[model samples]
Target: MATPPSLSPISPPSPPNTTTTAPPSSLPNNTAPPTPPVTNNSDPVADSPNGTFANLLPPPPPPRSVESLPPGTLAGLIVGVGLGALIVLIGAGIFVIFYRRRKKKLANNYSGAAPQGVDPQHWQQSVPQITVLPKPTPPPGITPHLYNSVEPPSTSTSLGSEKPSNASPSPVVAMGHSLGTFTYEDLAMATDNFTDSNLIGQGGFGYVHKGVLKDGKVVAIKQLKVGSGQGEREFQAEVDIISRVHHRHLVSLVGYCIVGVQRLLVYDFVPNDTLEFHLHGKDRPVMNWSTRMKIALGAAKGLAYLHEDCKPKIIHRDIKAANILLDESFEARLADFGLAKYSLDTDTHVSTRVMGTFGYMAPEYASSGKLTEKSDVFSFGVVLLEMITGYRPVDKIQRSLMIA
Candidate 1:
């Protein structure tokens, strides 16, 4: 009977996985609400609408457009992006500039010692301590003027008697001549390579030439060729001796040029020729009596300047008519200092090698070579005689010496 009940009461099982939802547990009480009464006033469709007609109330004003946001939003976003990129670029640029400046500054920095606060471009000179030296001392025979220059006394070296007498001459050249300097190129260009056409005169030590400078300034150039004639030291001596000597009657050395082996002296060019040309040339006028007297006085003044005014008495051993240069105004000047001899080196006369022209030399200097201030006086007398008589000293001496 049980078996038969199972078969009879069996129903198909629910599908395997399907789920069904149940209503809420809190169910409302079983009560009926009264329906509202519908009053018939006019056609329903005309009075009020429902369903699709009610839904068509302009579709709820079509939802607002998202792109129509407030004014600042999109602009703010774009500016923010641009500002961010600018900040990144600026940061990178600043970093690069800092590194480059630091690198360049370090590269330019120098560690070597230099003068304090000196720019190295201006006052950059430095005086190192170790480079200083003691002043030099003079050796024997260097101070030749203190005693006889040629023959030192037998006891002089042994005794070393350094004391001097009261009447010692100063070493200074006295009132000094105003001197000028010229560029070496000026002389070369002026003389046109020391041409023969420009040659005006010649001497034992040098040659003279007339020249015109680039500025149209006329000048005379005395080229001193390099040799051991007076020795290389003579060139320096000539400049030193002449620079310190000044007299109205003496020719003024205006400028000089020295380039290696070439040495040139510059003088104010005299427009007129030498006195010898006028005295000897037939075409030229003979010098007047007053002119000759002035010339003699000028020569005496030049000699007086050399002998009395200067510290060391200088004797122009070769004074002659050829050496007397004249200007356009006939003003006289004593020229040719290349053969000048000086003495009174110490407290007394310091004699060395005896040298002079034949006719103008003193009798004492010519024979024994023992010269003094008196020797120059004798030579001056000879020149005076020559000027007064208008006769050459050589001719007179030749005539007199042949008398025996």
Candidate 2:
């Protein structure tokens, strides 16, 4: 061999096997850690004491149910639910009680019940009076008391005696004497289909048409304006109030017709026109002083009757020359009860909506809606100024007739 390099390669000697002991500080003091047992890849058995996984997982948690709840917790939940139900029931009961009380109070107010501190007996015994200046001498042939001779019709011929009609009676009839009820068709025929030719007047509430009924009785039919915000209730209230009142100086309600939303009131027709026509109309003779005084007195008497004679006093809210209707004999008749209001005898002032002609309205009533009998009296005084001065209460140059 050593004679020539051997063609075969020789492997390097492997390092001699060496064993070195670790330092005491670096080595663990206890015995060597035990090796973990290897799990068999193909084994289906569970590694549990009883050869099942049930023990490995905590014994399956107890089934979830309300029964698992603690005794005190269950009782508290029941008590909470009961308390909530009780509270709801109590609130509903209180609401119903308050609602009933408020409704009853409103009804009493609307029905004009006697107010607190008012003695009904004492009020009945007393005669209410409207203070007035002494009256001037009346013109010849005209009686001093214009309406004294006129008597209310007997009960036999009153509205209560009217035969029942096909149309149902309005609730307004119950408040006063029963009134005749007419269908819309009956009224249409009487007024020739509400033609302009038959139109007698127009005002805030509606148009007035002259008509002749089948019974040959002449009447003034008032057709309330559509979309005027006036409804069956308001119309019924007006009819109820006016029907109960009967006076020679006051307009009378003959009957009323209701068709759907349409409301028509029938009244006895006055032969002559309104007092405004005679006082301020063109081509009219000027009213003399004595005639003016007579008119003033008559109107005052009517107002006084409304304010004093009525059980629940009526306030003629709108008082103006235009509202005064004249008869053939020039006797004054107060018409248009649309804006009338009822006032309690014990009330100092009735709070209401500010209504009435501009110049005729009292300053106190116009500024504040507190109305009283005195408010009507103030309007009457304005009318007196109009009669005396022969000028309009409100005019282009003078907005209001100021007292000197």
Winner by TM-score: 2
Global fold similarity of model 1 (TM-score):
0.51
Estimate, for each residue in 1-404, the C-alpha lDDT of model 1 and write its tens digit. Answer: 45553456668997667364554566558744445557777644464545554555454576677567577897998999999999999999999999999776544332212223323322111111111112222222233122110111111211123111222222221211234555555676788867899999886667889899888989988877654446233444445445445566777666555433445678878778876676665677666789888877777777777676554466666666777788877777887676565555453553545776677777777787666766667766776676666666666545654110
lDDT (10s digit) by residue, model 2, range 1-404: 45976687788999767575544555465767545557566523443336565534455477787657898999999999999999999999999999999899766634433334333322211111122223333323334431110112222211232211223333222322345667667888899988999999997788999999999999999887753554333455456556666677887788776444466889988878888898889999988888887788888878887887666678888899899988887888888877777776677887877988888899989999999989889988888888888788767667554551
Q: Rate the local accuracy (lDDT) of all candidates.
A: 0.58, 0.68
Superposed on all Cα atoms, the candidates' RMSDs to the truth, in angstroms, are 25.8, 22.2
Give the runs in model 2 whose Cα sits over 4 Å from its true position.
1-176, 231-234, 397-404
Give candidate 1's error at residue 271 in angstroms: 2.7
Which regions of candidate 1 deviate over 4 angstroms? 1-179, 231-234, 345-348, 396-404
Candidate 2 clashes between residue pairs 3 or more apart in a chain or in different chains: none
TM-score of each: 0.51, 0.56
- Give the per-residue Cα lDDT of candidate 2 at 55: 38
